[model samples]
Target: MVLYADPRRLRVSAVAEEVANGCAELAKTFRGPGAFARGDQLVRASLSIVSNIAEACGRGTVPDFRRFLLHARGSTQEVLAQLRLVKPTTEEDRRLVRSLQSRTVLVLKMLNRLYGHPPPDR
Candidate 1:
């Protein structure tokens, strides 16, 4: 049997860590004014996804969890939007954002399945 801990929860903690790391990596390459602001927004949106999921989990209700999942999905879209706004100067930054966006989509799909609905029409 698989042992489950709140901290080990895939949708909550694991994905959160992934987003945090991705954002941190992205933040390191900025070079001028507005860079910190842009980077902070990206990181905050990414972290929001995970934070909302955990918050919903603590509510201990399926509907609440589902609602939070929807919020996380919205935040995912926000990250994607911000990624599009920034022009990646390095191949590494481009690759990292692409990978992060792909994984985020997967997480959104899983959440949709868990919710028993089609992907949120975003």
Candidate 2:
């Protein structure tokens, strides 16, 4: 539980949370007649991104952290795919999805950089 010394530590989690909030906004916006039933998975997956990153930071070893980072990246990709399938019924939905899509892409890129070349355990 000692990974947040750096001021930049909030990068990934912040973006992940943004994605989650975006999903929630979508769900709330479309609340009724299933409340965007397909979004259930989307929301959960976005949340996974945040949780995995947090889990990674809490791990006792670098390898475990890296592994959870990979999981976060996978969840990021899932969010992207779900965003693609989101049938926005309003301009607000379209805007939200577009914003979420870009942010999700950024988070994926961030995760890729974070764990793609982590230093070897030494």
* Model 1 Cα RMSD, 1 decimal: 6.1
Question: Model 1 scores what on Cα lDDT?
Answer: 0.71
Best by lDDT: 2
Off by over 4 Å in 1: 1-7, 11-13, 117-122
Worst 10 contiguous positions by lDDT, candidate 1 = 1-10
Superposed Cα deviation of residue 55, candidate 1 (Å): 1.0
List clashing residue pairs in candidate 1: none
Per-residue lDDT for 40-106 in model 2, tens only? 8888999999999888876766678788899999999999998897788889789999999999999
For all predictions, the C-alpha RMSD in Å is 6.1, 3.3
lDDT of each: 0.71, 0.80
What range of 10 consecutive residues in model 2 has the weakest lDDT sum?
A: 1-10
TM-score of each: 0.79, 0.83
Clashing pairs in 2: none
